[model samples]
Target: MDLRDERELEVTRRKLHVLEARYEASRREPDENAHVHELSLRSLKRMINQLKEEIARFELQTLRK
Candidate 1:
């Protein structure tokens, strides 16, 4: 991994944090559309997971260098 890859990983990590916060906020807020909230939370969780995977891959790639 080069400088560009490192920057990308940092961006992805930041995005994961933002999504996690949004997911928590959604859980705490009372909404009339509970189903929609659940769907949105699920989507956010999925994105967080993907970003985590990307970060891990980038780190491992860097380590191999």
Candidate 2:
């Protein structure tokens, strides 16, 4: 993978970490934490998208080199 692709992946990984922290912070035993959970879910989706884009870019880069 190219450097840019790896950088983007790293950013997404950091975001995932932040999301996980937020998710844990919002966790309340015997109570619903919809908002934080939702944020975490959305972050997961964003992470997935980032990963897909990185994969696509890596594939194209491979084709070039």
Candidate 3:
């Protein structure tokens, strides 16, 4: 891949990593804040899923070039 493609891939990977970390943190919430934690966790999960889809599309586009 070219330099631009490599840079884009790296940025996407970093974003995925950050989202995963946030999801992990949300998963470790205590029972005292069940309602809030649940909402936060769900939001994080959705973001992670979207990011995964984005990565897949990016990879497919790169392969087509």
Candidate 4:
């Protein structure tokens, strides 16, 4: 991978890590309101999925280069 691609991958990975940590923390916290907790978890999950897709796309692009 080129320097720019490597840097981007690193940043993406870090973001994924942070998101995962937040998701885990949210899961462990007591639910004050069922609806709000569910919404928060869903949002975090969606963001995590998007980041994962981005990382996969980046890797594939790098591989083809």
Candidate 5:
């Protein structure tokens, strides 16, 4: 991969890591507002899924190149 592609991959990975950490922490915490907490977790999960899909697409494109 070129420098730019490598940098983009690294940045995406870092974001994934941060989001995963946040998801785990949120899961472990006890929030008074259960509905809001559930919504927040769901949002984080959707973002994580999107990021994972982005990473997978990037890897597949790189492999095909």
Candidate 6:
């Protein structure tokens, strides 16, 4: 891959990493905030799924090139 491809891959990797971290954090819980945690967890899960879809699309594009 060229430098531009490498950079794009790196950026996508970092975005995936951030989504993963957010998902992990959402899984954690503290006292007196069960509802909040549940909402946060669900939202993060949705974001994680979206990011996964984006990564898949990018990979497909790279393969086609």
- CA lDDT of every candidate: 0.81, 0.62, 0.78, 0.87, 0.88, 0.72
Please identify model 5 stretches exceeding 4 Å from their true place.
1-4
Best by lDDT: 5
lDDT ranking, best first:
5, 4, 1, 3, 6, 2
Residues 1-65 of candidate 3: C-alpha lDDT, one tens digit per residue: 22246677788779879989978876875768789888888888888787778778777878999
Per-residue lDDT over 11-64 for candidate 4, one digit per residue giving the tens place of the 0 to 100 score: 888988999999999999999799999999999999999888888888888889
Predicted candidate 6 versus true structure: per-residue lDDT over 1-65, tens digit per residue = 22246567778678779878877865764637888878888887887777677667777877889
Pairs in steric clash, model 2: none
Q: List the candidate 4 regions with Cα displacement exceeding 4 Å.
A: 1-4
lDDT of 1 at 63: 94
Sorted on TM-score, highest at the top, how do the candidates line up? 5, 4, 1, 3, 6, 2
The stretch of ten residues in a row with the least summed lDDT in candidate 1 is 1-10
User: Which regions of candidate 3 fall more than 4 Å away from where they truly are?
Assistant: 1-4
- Model 2 off-target regions past 4 Å? 1-31
Distance from true position, residue 14, model 5, in Å?
0.2
Question: Which residue pairs in model 1 clash with each other?
Answer: none
C-alpha lDDT of residue 20 in model 4: 98
**What's the C-alpha lDDT at position 40 in model 6?**
80
Report the Cα lDDT for candidate 1.
Answer: 0.81
Best candidate according to TM-score: 5
TM-score of each: 0.86, 0.50, 0.77, 0.87, 0.91, 0.70
**Tens-place lDDT digits, model 1, residues 36-63:** 9888888988887887887888788889
**Weakest 10 consecutive residues of candidate 3 by summed lDDT:** 1-10
Error of model 2, residue 33, in angstroms:
1.0
Evaluate model 3: give its lDDT: 0.78
